[model samples]
Target: MSNLTRTQEKELKEAFDIFDRDHSGSISARELKAVFKNLEISASDQDIKNAMKQMDINNDGEISFSEFSRVMEAQFYRKYTHEEIRAAFDHFDKDKSGYISADELRMTLSKMGKTFRKDEVDKMIKSIDKDGDGRISINEFMDLLN
Candidate 1:
């Protein structure tokens, strides 16, 4: 495997620090909850449970820093590319009006045959709609992507 970039490495280290509250080389559910809370992203109890299930590869109810970093790196790599990161605002700017609307986003993903429950979509939209405008602009979309 390739080494992480300096920025990614630093981010992983900081995340580890936050998630590793006890400095015991592992993260418990409480630490995970703190991380999510600190980011101001509201995670449902089920979401936290599911995350614990997925991140705790050994079924130990806790995640080692290395495991946590690996899971995060895998997910981050799947969603981002050098070129996409460089031109994301332009690439996902489907409206061509220099913005991304919720409708545009839903339509684009729908065209790809993806599926999401109405509640799921609503939750995601709510998170990204920082202005409460019922629409997502390019800047907002970029923030969500990051």
Candidate 2:
């Protein structure tokens, strides 16, 4: 959380608030499950239990914003090798171009069994496409994944 920019922290806070549906300050397992359902993320009972167990650092059967943000920061510091990251970017950059176009992103996701509409694909690209390039540069892609 300390390393996150203000905007990033704000976004995380918003996500946490989404899970904290009861205005309860903390997110109970039931609240998290409802949020997951609302997002159409098909998390299983075991998945929810495991997630709750992992994030409830205080063993309180709930996740505080601190706990949730800590887990998010841990994920931000993921352990992928540099080569692995490059390979992933390459996989998405289908034409071997230096940047990833919206079509390439959509096709790559589709090939990997992910189905996103055109607007969805565009939105994903827009989020990572810094410099108003309308495409994802390798640096931007690396910044996002690594």
Candidate 3:
């Protein structure tokens, strides 16, 4: 925690906030489970209970932000495999339109406040790729993710 830069801390806070659904300053198993569901993780209840047991850190049945941050930090050094990065990209892809170029990536992320269907995303990506004349490489996307 002491070695984390301010930006890293902010990123961790943002991630924790996503799981703290009730604004309770802590994350519960239900909240964690809901987020996992959204992320398309097929974790079982027992798996979640084990995760809670590992993350809560205080045996309190909930993960405080501090606990969450510590666990995230502990896991941060691992490099994402291609499959892992692709899975993360797929999670945000929403419409299954596949990857787009950098310009479309920025545009699509900017419009995240609105929902886009498969056809819409496909249309947008096709138009952008037609103009840009190239697609985004997985390595490039992985760099963006990093």
Candidate 4:
């Protein structure tokens, strides 16, 4: 029932193999922590624990190949429904306009305590505004999200 393509499934299997250092067909918490560290991915001990708990669906202390495949497939290939994307866009469009202005983006980010340089914001807007419009429409936002 996964949306992942054959290529994606193969890649996920390869990655899982790499993480399963012991070839035990499962990855332990210590192995997961080492993999994160080796990849320079910043994750706290608690974060790793939580991730294991979520991925280890069988309540096992380790993540089996099937579990890893399922989790990776969901994480990488799952797409949000149009209504969910629209609802999120509506939340940001404070003026009830169909587009999100750079000002609105700045305000939202500011509210979130995330400050970015003016150039950075402009770059972000330019990147997301696929139609070269000055603002991001719901369609554009959804495209960016996907």
Estimate the lDDT of model 3: 0.71
Residue pairs in candidate 1 whose N, alpha carbon or C atoms collide under 3 angstroms? none
lDDT (10s digit) by residue, model 3, range 26-125: 9999998987776567899999999999898889999999999888986566677889899877655555667554445544444332345656666655
Best candidate, TM-score-wise?
A: 3
**TM-score of each prediction:** 0.50, 0.55, 0.70, 0.51
TM-score of 1: 0.50
Tens-digit per-residue lDDT, 1-146, candidate 4: 77788877886887787788778999999889877775445799999999999899999799998899888887575688899888778867889889998888887655433567888788889989988878999989988668
By lDDT rank, best first, the candidates go: 4, 2, 3, 1
Q: Model 3, poorest ten-residue lDDT window?
A: 106-115
Q: Cα deviation of 8 in candidate 4 (Å)?
A: 1.7
Better of 1 and 4 by lDDT: 4
Each candidate: RMSD to true structure?
12.6, 6.9, 6.3, 9.8
- Give the Å shift of residue 68 in candidate 3: 0.4
Expressed as tens digits, the lDDT of each residue in 13-41 for candidate 2 is 87787677787999999988876675446
What is the C-alpha local distance difference test score of candidate 1? 0.70
Pairs with steric clashes in candidate 4? none
Q: Report the Cα lDDT for residue 131, model 3.
A: 38
